[model samples]
Target: MTSQASLSVTAETQENTLTEVFSLQKSAFQITPYPSLTERKHTLQLLHRLLVNHQQNIIDAINNDFGLRSSDESRIAEIIPSLQAIHYTLKRLPRWMKPKRRHVSWQLQPASCKILYQPLGVAGIMVPWNYPLFLAVSPLVAALSAGNRAMVKMSEYTPHTAELFKQLITDNFPEDLISVITGNADIAIQFSQLPFDHLLFTGSTQTGKKVMQAAANNLTPVTLELGGKSPTIIAPDYPINEAAKRICFGKSLNAGQTCVAPDYILLPENQLNLFIDAFTAHFQQMYPDFAHNSSYSHIINDRQFQRLQQGLVDAQQKGAKIINVSDFAPDATTRRFPIHLVTHTNESMLICQEEIFGPILPLITYSTIEQAISFVNQQPRPLALYLFSHEQDLHDKVLVNTHSGGVCLNETLLHVAVDDLPFGGVGPSGMGHYHGQEGFQTFSQAKSILKKGRINSTQFIYPPYKNKAINWLYKLLLR
Candidate 1:
């Protein structure tokens, strides 16, 4: 067959798979519109146990996909958090499921009002390649916690992990309750086009627009967790050494392959050397040898490695000073690239223009706090903002002056791990939220209900012409 014919065949198969699975989930949801709290808890329990039982398999699969994904990173960043999300949902679901009562006005004295949280039937989740397991399972926990059936579309970039997840989910879940679909961009397009009640996607900003556009065709509500150049602000008063330590920790995880990772830094103009020295020192202390260190993860694949390499080249050709934090040279065999911090970079370079989804950190200096705040505000709002400061005045100023999906004071990347925090983005960064109680609400609909008993109060004003008593009652109520 010709290449065109092959493409057509592939498209048709994906269409069929998406339709069949979505219909199955919708039918199942119809059968149990509002799942009992106990049923939801049981589902969460099974998921938690599945991770606990097959933890090693999950770690190995991710490592195989990444070529050198840290086993401890997988267990810490993926498995442990996934387990905690399930447990947190299980503990809070009872209260989340309860109908919230509202006070009814005296005019409607005989009626009772409340908001009943109802599942939005089937939910569609689009998982990203970075931290595949956590992104996939975190939203699943929310969907299940709110009593909805789910269909997840796993990224093709992580084929090994995707296949392993497919098998594990198939073994534990009924097809109608939850299903996993895997494919390239074409398959992801079809998955997004499906008529799900709600769609949640975690990926890049450019692709996020396409997903949102596709979802609009079906009028499906969506939650987008997209990436941007998240900025880190280091105040002059805060200890520069401590700030560098935290920033290095955040950026080194998965080689800065995280959505909420610090993409760049805004340092006080006088303290640039201090930050650079402290940052390099902290990174070296953390990983003594970069060339052979198993603790540091390699770039996910050749394409990503090339992207980072090209980005660094562009920064250098534009006259930006690139500082390699390690003594080891690039290793083609391992695909491990050393973390490079760029100074004197401008907006013309690709590193400054786009989200650096790798281990490249750009340092921009600011003379005043207002200038720092303005720099962050001028760009697309980020998924997270990191401010290293101890003063309440600076904290209040930054909080009120700028906007981001979430904020962390004197820390980095830990905000997302907090079970009580709502994780998401604002403006170009992304939209909607998940995690915590907000996640539960995202997958469920709050349906307002007003119940009235047999009462003749409304009959008093039903006449064609208002009488004296009716007029008096109306006046009294209006007063």
Candidate 2:
């Protein structure tokens, strides 16, 4: 067979496999549409044990994919969070599964209303390359906790991690219960076209739009966790050293590849030099020699590295001054790009226009607080917004004036770790939420049900409305 014919046959086989697995999951869900609370807890426990048993393997697989993913970073960001989510869900699963009593209106006095959190049958999760394990496991926790079967699509960029994860899941869980799909973009497109009861995707805004369009054909509801230029504002009253330390930690973690990492900073123009010095000092303290530092993570792959390099080149050509606080030279072979603080940037520059998912932070100075707020408001809504301020009024002002998926006051990125908080995006950043209680709801349907006992108060107006009693009832209801 020719090369093209061989490739076509392989694609056809993969598509058939996806369809078969989806059909199996759908049929399995039909058999046990509502899994018992004990069953759900057992599922979560199995997942927790899987992560615990293969902690080292997970770390090594991610490192192999990234060329130099930090072991500690993987443990801290991926394994720990996955375990915490499971534990949290296990503790609250019983309550979430119980029927919730709802108040009935006066007109419906004979009826009792309640909401049943029913499983969505099957959930489709699309994991991004940046945080492959965490992104995949987090949504899977929600799906299982809500008593739904799930199929996760892992990114091709992290092939090693994806394959390892798929192998691990296959060994521990039944294929029809929880399956992981691995392939390139073509496979991802096919996966998105599946008629899942609910779909949750985490990636870029452009890709999210396409996923949503594909899901629309099946009329599937989606919860998109897309990324945007999340901004940080440092108030004059806040301590510059404290603000710098927190922001640096957030940006340096995962080498600033986080969806909620502070993309840019807004500070008083006069304090720019002071803030820069403090930020530099703190960053150096975090990663003393970044090029050889094992704690510092490299960009995921060549494509991401090249994209970030091009953004830097475009910024410099457009009159932006790029300052490397650590002064570490980037090694393309290793793909270890240092944190760059960009200044004198304009809207035309790619650094200002795009989501800087790497370790590059742009400093946009403003004379007044209003100017800082206005600048953030003018841009597309972000996934996360950070404000460094001690004043209550200032915090309230920014919180009320701005729009984002989540807000961090006097800190950054830690909000996502809170097990009870919902994490997601808004506007161009993305849509819907999935974490803690909100996550359970997103994956389950809040089915409303009204019950009527032998006593039926609604009978008074059930027949033809020609009598005085019916007229009296209508007047009472309208009143």
Candidate 3:
């Protein structure tokens, strides 16, 4: 008991240390003057170098945390995309920083209007457990490219991965420029409340609201990447096999822990069994047997595992059908849980109420496209919405009727990979986007600049608003 107490106290002390480091970094940024464009470019280069050097360590750490994530999947999903973001920013930074010209009215004819891109000082990035490295570091890249210093707080759920990321930053860079913070929620709360110029959070919507409230005390700008129950609509016109393959791939990978994963299916009523059979066939082919495959990742932790368990239970209690997809019997060594297919679940059930961050997918049947669109419209916008339809008209219908952060037509959950497209959410799914050029804008502020020759057309309106000449000038220019 005494030893256990000591261990608990030691853990608490370590958590406090992380918060203190973040606070110090914030203060340092506050004291530093605005960073120059050259400096921003240098920071991005350093970040790119770090990612290249520590690729394997990051992959291994993620694997250790989540059991065994696919090596190629982790690299392509986490690092390659980030490196591309860096390269995209590097190639465009000069152009992006150029002052944007604006039309000045003829009344101010001698003046040229421009908008200068400026940094927003220190930025705090709170990363979620899923896709820890990519989500956190990617945002840091944007902040740095925009000439803002960043303090990253990696989720403690993946403690090993979190520590590895912190070490990577500490070994390569000074804490004043960039660093990783690792701790539990209380310490996260302390770090969140610090007066950073801006804060970027990627996590659940419920906690996102709390982070916003904390940052609000200082009126700090925020970018929230919250997850919602993203729905996938399988248009009756498409091939069931192709649609199933993509849908199952997105839903089964990392056991559907991905925020962008299709949360639930909105299928045509008559085609429910056809879609299920195709989906089940794909799921079987992917694993063959989940009882002993080390390639499959387990739940993040027991707490999360229990939550997944409860969601399945809730679906069952609410008269939802369960279609278990695993040959593995329950055991400790292979903590691999099967995916449940719970159809006809009400919105009150856990499967519908919470973001089902697991393999379990709740399939809802709809007779008409309008019904599915209406149901989806009533919910908060999702991170990504998938529509499987070869027909252009149905695709067009889905696009016009429903709202999401982004969309993938005739595909499932891969639109975020396109660096040219802005990746983020709307209403509830997320706020602000960050991937390529959009990311640069997310962290940059445009300061208006007006350059004028020695000609004052508006001088007559300086103090006296009633001057007839000024009124004539105002009318002519405004018109």
Candidate 4:
């Protein structure tokens, strides 16, 4: 068997080579003329075509890895998002890449100033397995648009997908532009430690900490997309059906595995019973037979499935009520997971503290929306917050007061679909934003340029603080 450090060493050596390749690319960026709009658009077109060519393999790989993902989910969540990101980048890149005009101060006179957007050389991206195809391509599209050479470390959980990505790169893109790294966690650890100009990682908070630490070795700017317990709040005033439908859509999608998925709910005590009833009805409606419903996804693997199982078991043992939300008879379905509910859980329980990234949603009742807000504030900031209330005031109040990666007003997890908005978390939820402008800025750097006038003026200010002309000018400016 190979030693633990072997993978790390191999990755380090490989990263060094890739870094040099990107350095040359950067040199080319400055001298060989920047990519034309048509060229960039063509690149996106090529990427889209590549995605379509591998559609069936992608669907099968995703199905094998996460049982919960269906062709529809992959098409919408992965393929379509990638296509949309390409479209978004294509439409906006010319404007985005244009130099931004800067205001010249009166003191500066005829001198002009502008801000230039430059690629950040090579970017090292570490993608998690959840939305392997989309998450990888979404950021890659941004990086490519920003004119940065990219290196991606595909998650080990989805080997088929990773292999497919490697094949695609091998077939189409030159290694000097972009490359893929595929292996286990050892390789990931090493990849993170590379001297990339910038790095982006999408994973758990624990893993994110490790990635940040590794990136610190090179003072590499990092974008972390981590997960925490995101809360969904519902007021008594809202239509219960609407709340249930939206919340259920989020929770049931990917079997509640998304980083922005609603982990738990905070609601009025009187509405708890009714909310659960409506949610159960919605879940049943979505999955008439959860066991075999092709649309309903399974937990990633046996390890995650076991962890979800243990979390529910621990909650049940701690005096929490387990609401059975699955409607299918056990014999009818191949899926082992059931929709589990735990109410009255303590703060210290596994389900309460950690992000419950499964279909099991815990419930907490509050006397008022204020209590719900307070509860959320005490914990680490979440990646997403879902609020359900017809009252515009309550929605506005939460929007103003709460800190989160993003907010889904009066619904759950739909805001991320809005391509105009940036998707990311703050604090424990995550440390950077991506999508739209945020994605572009993350992958590139802002370089400010100041033009000098033909004649040098006020040389008196350069050498000493004692010059009368400079002193008089400074006094006049300050006063």
Highest-lDDT candidate: 2
Backbone clashes under 3 angstroms, per model: 0, 0, 0, 3
Model 1, 49: alpha-carbon shift in Å?
0.7
Name the lDDT value of residue 355 in candidate 1.
95
Q: What is the C-alpha RMSD of each candidate to the true structure, in Å?
A: 1.5, 1.0, 2.7, 2.8
After best superposition, candidate 4 residue 427: deviation in angstroms?
1.1
1 versus 3: better lDDT goes to: 1
Candidate 4 wrongly placed segments (more than 4 Å): 1-34, 328-335, 460-472
Candidate 2 per-residue lDDT, tens place, 171-246, comes to 9999999999999999999999999999999999999999999999999999999989999999999888888889
Off by over 4 Å in 1: 461-465, 473-479
Instruction: List where candidate 2 sits over 4 angstroms from the true fold.
Output: none
lDDT against true structure, model 4: 0.82
Q: Which wins on TM-score, candidate 2 or candidate 4?
A: 2
- lDDT for each of the candidates? 0.93, 0.93, 0.82, 0.82
Q: Report the error of model 1 at residue 51, Å.
A: 0.4
lDDT by residue (48-155, candidate 4, tens digit) is 888888888888888877754777888878888788888887888889889999999867666889987777877888999888998899888878787777888999
Which pairs clash (backbone N, Cα, C closer than 3 Å) in model 1?
none
Poorest 10 consecutive residues of model 4 by lDDT?
327-336
